[model samples]
Target: MSRDIDYGNLMHSAMRGLIKTVLQDVADHGLPGAHHFFITFDTSHPDAELADWLADRYPGEMTVVMQHWFDNLVVGEDGFSVTLNFGDAPEPLYIPYDAIKTFVDPSVEFGLRFESAEDEDEEEPSADPMPPAINTDHAQEDADTAQKSDAQVVSLDSFRK
Candidate 1:
């Protein structure tokens, strides 16, 4: 067995750790200033827990905004649970970190997008592992402007050996 450092997996783990830390801080002291998040996760993930109605509405993936009105945020080692208001009804959701697809904080123009393992497998094999794409776009932009241009995405290839 050849020993090799899996930088791609390492980077993914580090990014997830960063998300966990950020959420933990928010759960402790609440969101600060204009810092908010738009998190998109796979509702079909085995560990993802949500209301049946929500599952029916969003069969594949769902995006949740953590800005003005979210409560009972509890971040754990594996996942986080939060209660969000939807049409005057509060719904509690538990999302595992592994289920997360994209996490964006447009307030600071920062975002991270995770590709599924299957996506990586579909790509042609190469000596170097492909880095996940990081989008730095403003979600507050008008729909037309947003659609006109693609978000600038930065890759971690340059940082790799």
Candidate 2:
């Protein structure tokens, strides 16, 4: 019997692991280091729930600043929940493991992207049998990570000299 090595499953688990780490850090130590996330996700993802009000507002993807604007963020086993203030009202959103599309930080210029399993499975299979959606070779794909690493190395050179 042969089993499938679903790249979607692999990527999903890997992304979840990264998110779990960040959530755990915030839960235990209260946002340490220069890491805070600007998470933008598919609001309509099956596991995601937004009041009709907010859903209509953000039909595609919406970015939330986790640094100073969020309150009562809770991390759960399958998903995480956070409350954000829109105007005079506060809206609560729960994003499941599969809903997250991208987590970005403009400050540090680092990003973690999560692909939904459904989206992955929708891809047309090439002759290779296994298709990888996350590619780091492309310039646009790794711009943030490369840019930050370059900036850090440049700054570190001064201290070494």
Candidate 3:
């Protein structure tokens, strides 16, 4: 006996909830409360372009924060672009919707995640494993070193812990 799943339509249906929450705030109030997005993506995608200098500086994955200070903020049907302050340098970047990998907001208790183009091209590196927790976003910090304000990066195994 065999059974099949309509995974494409199933995933599309689930992602709708995440997209709704994130876009709703941006659409209605121009950004919700103190919550902002930290979207990480592939800078080399066909529809992607960042300052050549930044592309070289962060070759693999770079995370950008979407907050009020951004300029030329526009969400298009295909992609989005805005001027973001990288340290003291303000750089403009364009990212295709397809390039987006993960969207995390530490301000809220929720997270919106997606896969990267590279994910289909190769197998991901293996890592140490663990158990599960109440909130998968929770992470550990070095009491003497790591800053308190950093975004949480829970271990993938933390979901099972």
- Using TM-score, rank the candidates from best to worst: 1, 2, 3
Q: Candidate 3, overall lDDT?
A: 0.55
* Poorest 10 consecutive residues by lDDT, candidate 3: 128-137
The global Cα lDDT (0 to 1) of model 2 is 0.59
Task: Note each model's CA RMSD in angstroms.
Answer: 6.5, 11.4, 7.9
What candidate 1 gets wrong by more than 4 Å, as runs, is 121-161
Winner by lDDT between candidate 2 and candidate 1: 1
Q: Model 3 residue 39 lDDT? A: 71
Per residue, candidate 3 scores C-alpha lDDT tens digits across 1-161 of: 99877564356445544554455457556776767666767777778989898788767767666654566666666667767766557778888766765555656634444533343355764261111111212222132112213445432222321
Per-residue alpha-carbon lDDT of candidate 1 for residues 96-156, written as tens digits (9 for 90 to 100)? 9989877766666677767666655675753422222212233432531332233332343
Mark the regions of model 2 whose C-alpha exceeds 4 Å error after superposition: 116-161
- Candidate 1 vs candidate 3: which has greater lDDT? 1
> Which pairs clash in the backbone of model 1?
none
